[model samples]
Structures are given as structure tokens and as C-alpha cells.
Target: MRRARTSFGALGAVTSVGVLIALIAACGDDRGGFIKNDRAFETQSEGGAPDAETCLLQCSLDGRSIIDSCTGGVVETCADDLACGAAKCQEPCAAAEADRSSNGCDFYFTQPLSAYPFASCFATFVVNASNKPATVSLELGGEELDVSGALFRAVPNSTDLELLEGPIPPGESAILFVADWDPTIPRSLGERLYHTSCPTAAKPAIQADGYFRSGIGDAFRLKSNVPIGLTWMYPYGGAGTHFPTATLVLPVSAWAKEHVVVNGWEANVGEPVTQIFAAEDDTEITIFGSKDVTNGVGFAGATAGMPAKIMLSKGQFVQIAQSQELTGSLVFSNKPTATVGGSECANLPSKAAACDTLAQQIPAFEQWGSEYVGIGYRPRTANTEEIVWYRMVGGRDGTELEYDPVKPAGAPTTLSAGELVLFRARSNDAFVVRARDAEHPFYLGMHMSGADGEESDSPSHGGMGDPEFVNVVPSGQYMSSYSFYADSSFSEHSLVIVRKKTHGAFKDVWLECAGNLPDWKPIDSAGQYEYRRVDLSRNFGPGDSFGEKRCTTGLQRMRSEGAFSATLWGWGKYASYAYPGGTAFRKLVEIPLSPVN
Candidate 1:
């Protein structure tokens, strides 16, 4: 019983004769007389004749009622006030014929900062969770792009505008290298090569991610099956320096015009940046800045507590960076848009020596959840405790939050709309958070501890881990199965899984690499939910300083009898990346935008 809300435009236009035949065939009654309901067909002509397309569109909008009538061998008359010639009457009549489930089919991608001097080898891992092999393609502004010979390669060079297609087997994944760089070449040399090979009227300065050409900033469309999941990552970065980050790519169906950025790290330690991408033309966006936004164009400089407006078309985007943290900033658009927030390189607690690049696609306020299970990364060493930081942002005014075991020190019990709070916890100290109800949902973020050598006197004691940010998927949005990728570039890869014990024991869960997740621990005394930390691969040590490993162990598939949530993360010497395994992208609320002053 899926409902189609948006206009199909010219795609829905059909010949009047064809529509008439469909209406006649669908409206026939056993008594040889037309079924008529005055309430449903009030908009019919004075002669009691229905408009072909309007009637079909109305029936589609009626959803379950029309289906029920048809199942009971009764055909209810369908009509709408919209004229058949009007654009509103032009709807996809086929929408009512079948249910179109969201397999994460259509989505857009954006690259965050990887820092200068670091090789920006951007790649997206598409996992086919369907039963049938799926074809994957990328497009920008209606033009297909080439990704031939780019599968699983760190650095790929492809010709422009060439349509390249690939298939991903069911329960397996394929890597698409959208942007790549030759690490042997220095940043300056790479920039020169890019400009010489693809010169254009506007030569924008080289980005922190080291992407100097066009199309990198443009939002590219990824088409695939509805059950697929995408994880975007920059596999390589400066050795023993700025680390890379990964984030789950939210599909276009999950996108919204309104979002709020949660503070992941201290702004003073490094530059905090935010980016917005438009999926449609003529999109007007307004940002209510929580901090001063610098290095942005097409809008006036935004000061803290001020508003900035910008316009974008399909595939177009704007990146905004600032010295101050942009947490709690409100982004509103006239059309649905995707927003990403993070830092170029930020130190946790603002005192850790090592900093890592952070990135997470901000979900719409409507998708915020009232319940979340907070789990940290695995311990850096066998003896050391796994310490992590958590940040929660409120999506509504007067949102009240409650913790299952006990609230950590300095955690807030209540928050105003767009307010943010931070707290610390240990890896094994798992807890559940619940708001007053679903109406007062909030966003939760997890941050890995920096490699500050606190565990031992040596500076490299905690060198394998660093500050990284990953959004905590809501418990309600957990899916039963997931196909995700773990970058082989990282020495250690693991998954944090949480499932309801009431539905079934954790033993019911199955992973392609590790069967039945042998390790399970309870979160609280209630015994309703249980969690486990499973290692996919661990080769971190002296020889593997750069976090490189065999590519065969990168893709992973997991399933459970009931809904469960999982987080994929890995770390090596001063490098780490984390993101959710997948999300259902269910709409939980409707958050209105604030009036622009």
C-alpha cells in the first residue's frame, strides 16, 4: 500500500484512448452497471462520466480502500476535483498496481575533507542485499558517467561521460571509485595534472580533499535495488597524521529539506565544515548558523546567530567551513536536500594530539529517534578500557531524555530545539536512551577516542585509534539484514550489533564471515536487548602501520531473524572510520522550519 505524493510530470502523460480503456476495464461491475458512489465521484461530469486520468490518480491516492474494494469484488467509482488536463491529474497510474519498497535504490554522494597532502581516493561501496543480482550506475544532471575498471581499485582513471555498467551479486558488494589520486604524485603535481588534462573556465582552488577538477562536488545519482546499502570512504590518508572517515550514504527517499548538524568535535581544534546537495532544480536553502560560517560563496557571510540563504539546482552543492563548531545549525530548503557535517581534522576533547577527519550524513529531523543504544569502538589494546564520547542533539523544544541504567555525568535531562549535549562513556558500558515519547526525538553521535598515548608512556600506545564520528542509527530504524563493506586499508575491522532479546536470542543472528555471533552481552537488567562486538579482521601491528590488508575480506553480509542494528568500524595507526551498517529510513516525525527573519 505505497502512496505516491509527488507529480510525475511529463513521465505520467498518456493517450486519452489508452487511459479510457484502462478505466473501463478496471471499473466493470458484475451487474453490467457502473458502480457509483456520490462521495467518491462527486467531481464527475454532469452526465455522470468520469475523467480517465483523474479517476485513476484518485484511485491510487485512495490506497488501501480501493484495494480492499477490488479484493471484495466491488469497484468503487473514482473521481477527483482536479481537471484531467491539469498537471495534478497526471499521476503514475501504475503506482497503485504494485507496492514499491525502498531498497535504497536512488541516492546522492558527497565527499568530505581528507586534508591537503593526503591522497583523496574516494570510493563508494554498494552492497546488493536483494536476492537477485543488481546493476549499479552513476549519473549527474541526466548524463551517465564512466566507472569502468574502477572496481575495488584505490586509484582509477576513466574517460568522461562514458557509460559504464557493472553488476553486484546478491549478498555481495562492489566498489566504485568516483574520485582517485596517484599517491606517488605530490598534491601540487596532481593539481597541475588535473588542470592540464581538464581545463575549464573556472579553476577553483584545490580542495582540502585534494580534488581539483569538476564533478567531485556535484551530487552524483546512484541507482540500484531498494535493499542496497552504500558506504562512502577515503581509504588512504597521510601516514601517521590526518586519518580518513566513512559514513553511511542516506538514500534520496530519506532526504528532507530540514536538518541539524550535531557537534562532533571541538571547533577550536580544527575546521568544522558542512555541505548541502540539491536533488531537484530551483532549490532555495537557508542556513540558521550556530557558528560563523567562512569560506562560502553565493551567500553573504554568516555570523553566529545569523541566517544565510543560497540557491542550488540539481547536482549542485555548496560547502561551508568555519572555525567555530556548527552544531545545532539549522538548514532549511524549499526542495528536498542532503546535508553532511564534520571536521577537516579534529581532536577529541580538544586536547588529544592526534586528529582524524570526521564525516556523517545528517539525517532529516523527521527521522530522529526517541530510542538509541550507545556502543563504542573496540578497545585499542587488550588491557586498556575503550573510552568514547557521545553527543545528543534535540529536534524539538522541551525534549526530555531518560537513560536506562543511569545518566552519565554532565548529561542533560531536557533540551530545547536544536540544543546539543555531550558526555563520555566506556565501550563495555552500553546503555539505552529514551525520550518522553516519539514526538520528542533526538539525534545521537558516537566519537572514538584519540590516540593520545594515555594508556602507556609511549606516544604510540593508543596510536591505532583516533577521534572519528559516526551517527548512531535509531533502534526503530534497524533492518533485519544488511550488506556492508569494511575497508581493507584498515588493519582492524569489527561490527557492533544490537538486537532485542525478546524477539529471539542473539544466536539467531548470522554473519557470512562469522556465524551466529558467538559473543553476546546484556545491556541492562531488563534483558530486553543484547549487544555483541564481532571482529571481522584484525591485523594491526608494526608491519601493518598503514592499515593495508587483503581486499577479499572487505565485504561482509549479515542477517537476523528479527530487526537488528549494526555499526562497522576499523582503526589503525592514527587512522579510523565508522558508519552504520544500514537503516530503514522510516519517517518518524514532521519538523517545521523556523521563519526566516
Candidate 2:
């Protein structure tokens, strides 16, 4: 027999009187008015406890009051007029409970070791998107981090250290720097002759909690007062000289049973890696390699044109590193899972002077967008135009693509499922991509160019930035507001924004540090949408080297009266990172279930 369960958190607040009236009608009056202690009671009776089943029946009839009273475990307080004698309440009550339990929340990270351990820096920024203040904390391998003192620190210039153990105000954010714990040890006597600090850092433990704990190869469990917007940034690479990247972190509601990783940085220069983390136990996974995966011999012998299989338990992950490109690879699982792909460090155009790490969580095909706006990064110097690389992958065969302001050379007119095309646009160029319709959604990614050997200290270099990868947020997923972070480690930072020209909020859009966004440029002759670039800081060379003293850059907030999309990025000499400001993770497609062998 099924045990009776309380409906405390399962039911949402009742919205209307009509719903209550309808439920009462469904129960009918012929069954008798009220059931008190298993005995019939007068409709006007004010006292006596109602039977559990009967109380639930009345809960559906009187809106929230009686439901709240009964679910609060005070059964005697149930209203007598709720017609608690009904025998038909069990089914609907059970259904409501089942629906609530089905919802889940989990998050994953992809912070692989960089080419040089000393160059690795990982951080996560989270914003309370809800109206209420949010209490946020993190857990790894089942043990919670001491957010109050160990992992979190006060933001840049803010003295409110309490925000670290927040009740962070609505629209505010909490930042976590993994390096705070000191991933490296003090230099030894013998090594002091050759090295200034520890020569190498320790690998993140598979299971542990405390200072020096690495988040690598683990799932991050975020507990918060409400839904949040998250972004992961890995700044500095290659002996702390070059390579940096970032990505928007999708919530568990966006996890799917299938996904296709978009291409990473130039495939020939450095190791291209892909990591898949499971959110459930015994998740069976299959990989259809799009390139000759270098490490294929180990993980089910994955190879180009061949399928590989494996299984992962909750919080466990499998990392695949190779020299070949992993773009177009398909990841399918029996249960929902998350995947992140990129290169440890790569050169743009495959032959650029400097390389940067490229990393972004792959959104499931269900979240692909049918329309996108491509905007390039602001020029490195007032005179030099930055070239941005854009790639689009098809979600369905025969997908037709339309571009405004004249499509560039190499742009495809059509694409087959799992196929992709790459093109280039100048920093000042802004364009729109539209599919035949919502039925032909596609994925879009933007790549930054390398610094081309520009010196960091050159007064005219404008803080030359290197290659980075960022997944473009679809116009369909735009939100009215966003709270993000800009790392001071970078010498310059900026935001690229796109919004409908018809949106009334366009003129009202504002950034926290900067005032109203100005200088909006329309895309081509369409006049349907517009784009703008706002710099948070410009050409400001690195400040204090210590973590706590870097106050020139930190959290940024933006909002509008209507929906809009934005991307946040920052760059230092030979290094850079970029990520979507925020996006809604509505499921846009469905994946058919596959049997596990």
C-alpha cells in the first residue's frame, strides 16, 4: 500500500477562487458535508479534527487557507465547510506530490588542468535572479564548503564580507575563487635555486573538502534561496603567460539525454578535451566521434566514424583529451547528463602567435536557438579592428539559414544535422542569423583572435587579448536583467548587447557601473534589432597581484524594461575569457529514449 504523504511543499499557492469552486463541484455535495474523526459532522461545526483523506479533499476546495492549515500538520484547524467527507481526493493529491518530486537541480564544471599548472585559475560567479535575497553555498563530493571563510571572499571594493555567507541581496552576486585555497605548496629549499614558488600544483582530489581542494573532475552542488545565473571563468594559462576562457553554466533543468559539442579552438595547436559528468547513477553514455579522438583507445575505443560506450555514476566524470578537433561529436546517455568541451590551449586561425584555453559547457540540442545575433569584440586599439570567428551547427537536416547585412564568405546557405560552418566578421560588423523557422534551430559560437605577438606593456597595444570561445545566447532566451562578473586579472573588460529594435525597454537599458547604454547601431536594412558595445574598463593594465587587493574589477549588473541578450568578456596581454551574460534554459526539443545495454 502507498503511504500517505503530506502535501506541504508539493502544492503551489492557489491562484483563483474559480479553481476552488471547480474542485468543490468535482467533489459534489451528495457525499455529505464534513468528516470529523471518521464521523459525519455538521457543515457549521467549528471544532474537531478531520480524517487525513477528508482534510486533503477540503484542501482542494477552499484554496490555500485550509490546505496550508492541514499541510502545516495542524489537522484540527481545517475549515469545516470544505466538504472533507469526499472519498475521491486520494488520486489528485498523489498526482500533485508526484509532480513536485520530479523536479531536480544540479550543476557541473569543466576545469581541466592547463598546459602549465602555475597558469591555471578557476572561478565561478553566481547572481540571485529572483526577487528575494538568496542564501548561497556550495558542496562537492557530498561535503559542503565553508562559504563564510574558506572558499568565498568579499567582492572587489565592497566591505560587506557577510555577502559571502549571504542572504545576498536580490540582483547581487557571490564570487568563488578556487585559487583562494592555494592549490600549490610553499617552495622547498633545493628548488628555491631554480623556482620562485612551488614548481607544480596538486591535482584536485576525487573526493574531499577543505582548503586547497580542487573543483576539477567533480560536480558542484549549489544550494540557494532561488534560481540563479552562473558563469565559469578560467583565466591565465601557459606558465601564467597566455590562454583564458569562460562559459555560461546551465542549470540541471537544461540537462538532456543528448548533446552535440561545437568545435573548439584551432585543433592542431594544443590538446582538445571533452568532459562528461553524470547527474544520475548508472548513466549509460555513447559517443559518436566526429574527429579521430587522440585518446580514443582508452574510453571504449572511441574513434572517428565509430561509436564508443561507457557508464558513469552521479558526480563521476570521464575526461577525453586529443589533438584532433572534437566538434560535431554526439553525446547520448540513458539518463540526463552534462558535457564540456574545449582545448587546453589553442592558437586562432591554427597559426596565430599566441594561444588561449577554450572551454564552454555544451547546451543540449533541445536548447539550440533558431535565431541569433553575432557581434564582435571591441577593437584592441582604437585603430586596429578585431576579427571574430563565428560558427553555426545545424540541429536538423536541410536547415536553411538567412543572414542580414550580407552574409560573409564561407557562410553556408544550408546545413545538415550535426554539420557546421565557420565565417569571419570585423569588430564593427553586426549581423543577424535567422533559420527557416523554430523547426530549424541551430547552435552558434564566437571565437576571439590571438594578440599576434603584441607586447603587454606597449602603451599603444590596448591590452592585446588572445583567443577565447563563447557560446552565443539566442535572442529567444534573452532576459530582462542580468548580474555578472568581470575579472580584474584582465586589463580590459566589455559587454556586447543585442535587443529587438521594437522593444520599448531598449532606451531604458542600464548598466550598474556605467549609466544608460548609449550608441545603439541597427543591423543592416532590417531595422528590426540593434547592437551595442559597452566597456567596463579600458586599457587599464593589471593592478595589484594579490587576490584581495584587486578592486578595480568585479561584479556587474544590467537590466532593461524588456528582454535582451548580452555577453561579458575581458582580456589581458595574450589572455582572455568570454561568456553569455545570462539565458533562459527552456527545453526546445525532445530526445527519444534509448535502451541501456
Candidate 3:
């Protein structure tokens, strides 16, 4: 809901608004009991500004400044056509005004000399706004860019305001300031928040993943072909699904062959597991469950959506019944003395070579299976320091977890038998740390597709066709079609999904990281140059094929008004871009394939 404020004479002398609703009822007379006469009356009183010119400027009913007034104190009002403006003004006006009248919103940043060598830097303001019936335009360093609207609605009398440019409408907020770029690109080193519509208090309860960075360069020069693992720390425990802690004690050999290529690079992955030799104390809790060892029979594990049979499985390999592959890339370092730039890796030498010696690796395939396990934990406290950490268990597959608190002398708790034992992380970092998946003797970075003879300071990144995902277009524009598949085959009667409010000219999208949902970094940091893919597919009930070759109603409602939080994540391989009818395609290949296994 949108809220407006009214003051008496000063901004501090504010009064609360109360809306009084009125209701009326007809009087009825029975027999002749004092039913001689009846009267009707009604009245309404509300704490709102009066509808008059005086009310527009100083609000005669309340004495606050007319916030939405135009030049000459012309009162501006929000009607059906002003929803976006109304929403924008809800809190920003109050907050921006407070900022403008204060000591300023500049931050005190201190960094190592190596990271930022320049002596000093100045803050630049770039505003992009359209006054609608008025005008809007944008300029930088006295140069006019190809902006479409008039640019008059900027700060007029304030120096600080002049330094910061925009007064753009809420709709164009994404383009107000692209980035605080330096004219001279630094040889190396870089770094850089937004308001959440959700209440600040409520956000603490919402679990979030930390945006992890490995700090590896995009190219690697290798002398020998040794197995190097590229990893990003999860920082916490169980994500949407796939618990790792239960699989830890199954022996390291069990996970050696279970490698999977995430974001196009091979990763040695496995689930985290824990075990107990014998019941030690009553404070210890053990969770128990069983495995369904039906050969050649596969069903979807507990994950994000509906359960479907495995599209393909073999020996110990299971595929999600789709053609899209899940993968991540590797970055390489030039300094032989530095392992992946000497951050995550340990071993190093003193030489360098051409950056194309390393080749991308894919995981071997395995037939799917389920298992039962027991879990135990101790009580935890807020003061726990270093209480959360990630370690390697077996394969690249891992589970994020936290240490249980120490129970009293004799109060061990355990879950003995259950279909599945799910664990939840209580702390923010606990949810992301995967001890098993992150297990590696060392870390390394490399360019996956091979090396280009370009300098490290080159402006252009190495590859061009890194598979652009997540492309958001404006309303009424065409969205390319992508493929969709269920884990287990459904007879088509289980569910139906649709995209709502998914239209608009998206300006802040990270297009490079499309398709792979888990690969997406949170859209929080401003200067991060990454993108996420938007999967344009859905499911439906039996006999509900959209067409012989496609699923209908997939991208139809992308622009409707009811849409707000437009989010999509899934996986599949790219098919033909311009297929029949101009639709793009992504197909999930049959699992246990030769290239991956």
C-alpha cells in the first residue's frame, strides 16, 4: 500500500491520518410502538488534504508542503494513470528529501593501495527522468547521450543535488546511472546495494545465499595436464534439495566417478554425509531412513517441483530427464607461483606458459538411487564464532551444515526411522557451506574454451558465444522459446504453470548467466557484471499438448498487470535459434551419454 504524509507547519509537526467510513440503515416500525416518525442522517470525516488550491500548497487541512506540486504550486494528484508514480513516491520522496537536506550520503571507503592506487575520487551523479507532460534527458561530463526525454527536472539550487543527476520516473529507475566508470580502465582490481520492497524486519527470516567469488582470472597457461578443480564455496547447508551430510561416510571411492559438469565445466561433486559407530550419548540425535533399490525404476527426488520419473538412468547415473546441462566455467592464472592467483589453491611453481593446455572435463554417469540415514545435532548459540565452515567429504556433491550444540549430561535426541531426513541450516552462512562438494586438495582457475593471445588488460572479455541466457525484453516484444522437461514422465494431468507480469523492458538483467538457476548471483551488487537465464517453459495436465512440436501458453501472459516478482530457473541445452516459426529450442538429451559419462 502507498502512504502519503501531511504536516502542520513544520515537517516535524506531523499528524496521523484516520479514515472514517459511514454506513446507513432504514428504520422499521412494528405495530404502533412509537413508529410515528423517522429521521435519516449521515456524515463523514477524514484526515486528508482538502481539494483546493490552498490545500495543494500548504494543505489547509494539514500544513505540510505540497509534495506532488508542480511549478507555481500547481497541485499534482495520483489517479488511475499514476500507479507507477504513486508507488515510487511512497517512501523515496521522504527518504530522498531527508538525504538531500542532510550532511550527504557519501560513504567513507578505505581500501588497500594495491586495490585502488589513485589518491582521491569524486562522486558523480547521473539522473534519468521523464516529467511526462514535461520533459527528460540525461548528460554526462557535458556530453549528451541518446536519451529520449527532456532533462529539465533536475536539482536547481543545490550544489550537492547538482552533483547527483537523476529525477527520473520510477519506470526508468534502472537506467538513471549505469556505473561509476573511470576514464582510464585500471590494469586490475575492482569492486562495488538496493532497497528491498519487503520490510527490513521480515528479511532476516528469509534465507539467502551469499554471492561467492573465487577471484580467478579468465585464462590459464599450463605446462602439464593435471586434474584441477574449480569451486565456489556454498557457505551454508541444504539448498532447495539434495542433502549431502548423509552421504559422507559411504567411502571416498563411492564419489570418485560421480563428477558432474556444472555451468559447462566438470566438477567432482557429491553429497555430504555423517555417521555414528555406536550410540554414544543421549544428547546425540540420529535420523534414519531407507533406500529403494528398484533396478531401472527411477522417480524424482524431493526437489523444487513436482516429482517425475527419470528420463534416463544407468549403473549409478541419473539425469533430470531433460536436455539442458548444468555447468560452471573455470578461470586460470598466469603466475606459476600463484595457484589460481594464489588465493584458493596451495601448490605453485615459478613459471608460466600458453593458456590453452587445460581441457574441460565432464562427470561420469550413474543410475539414481535413494537412501535412509540418521542425523544428530547439539544446541547452538548466537555467540558461536567460526561455528560455520565448509570441508570436503567425498565427491563434488556436498551438503551444507552447522555443528549441533552440546547437550546436557544425558539428553541425546535422534530420529530413528523416516521416509527422508531433511536438515535445515539456522544461520545465514550455515545454509551455504557445503563441506562435501567443496572438498579439494587445492583450487585453480582456467579459461575453459582455450586461450586468446590478448593482454590481461584487454577491454574485451575472451569469449563471445558463452551462451547468452536471461534475455528480458519490453512489453509486446517476442520472447524466444526454450525447452522444458519433467524429471519423471507424467501422463500430463499433474500440474500447470504460467508466467505472470513477466513483461517490460528489463534494464538490469545479467544476461550471461541465463538458464542455470543455481548459477545466478543475487541481483544485489551494483557493479557486478553477471546475468541470469530466464527459462520460458511450463507444465500441464494430460492430453494438454500445446501443439505437435511445442507447449502452448508458455510465453503468452508475460506482460499482464498481475505479474510482479517475475522469476524463472531451470536447465536444458540450446537447440536451433531460428527454428520453424522463428522459435528457439533447447533439448534435454537422453541421460548417461558418452560425452558426460
* Sort by lDDT, top down from the best: 1, 2, 3
Best by lDDT: 1
lDDT of 1 by residue, 1-597 (tens): 111111110001111000000000000000111123211211222111223422222122222123221233323432332111111221212221111112356767655653442334455666664445667666644557564554432221111122224566655565565443333345465444322111122111111122311111345566764245677665332233246677777766667877887645667455776767777877888878777755343456567667777777676666666667778888889899877777767877677768776778778877777878887767778776666778888877888777777676677889887788888777778988878766788889988867784334223334677878988877656555566666555677667888754222343777665556655787855555678777666773212111332222355666653456778777777778788776655566645646546
Whole-model Cα lDDT per candidate? 0.55, 0.53, 0.15
Weakest ten-residue segment in model 3 by summed lDDT: 21-30
lDDT (tens digit, per residue) of candidate 2 on 1-597: 111211100001011000000000000011111222211111111111111323322222221122222353423332322222222233222221211111112355535434433323345566554345656566554456554542243346432333254476655665554322122346445433321111123221111112111111334555554445666555322123355567776656557788886757645566776777676777788877777644332245455766677666555455666666677777888898877767767777676657766777777777677778888877777776566788788877778887887786677889887787878777688887778665677889988777773333222333377778878877655544566666555667777888653222244566665556667788856565688777666555422222232324566666653446778777777778787766655444444322223
For each candidate, give its TM-score against the true structure: 0.72, 0.71, 0.18
- Model 2 scores worst on lDDT over the 10 consecutive residues at 17-26
Local lDDT at 99 for model 1:
17
Write candidate 3's Cα lDDT for 326-377 as tens digits.
2211111111011001011100010111111011111111211111001111
How many pairs of residues collide in each model? Answer: 4, 1, 86
RMSD of each: 14.2, 15.8, 28.7
Name the candidate, 2 or 3, with the larger TM-score value.
2
Error of 3 at 503 (Å): 21
Identify the runs in model 1 with alpha carbons over 4 angstroms from their true place: 1-103, 117-119, 140-142, 153-166, 182-217, 225-227, 236-242, 453-460, 501-507, 540-552, 591-597
**What is the Cα-based lDDT of residue 267 in candidate 3?**
16
Measured with C-alpha atoms, the lDDT of residue 345 in candidate 1 is: 76
Per TM-score, the best of the predicted structures is 1
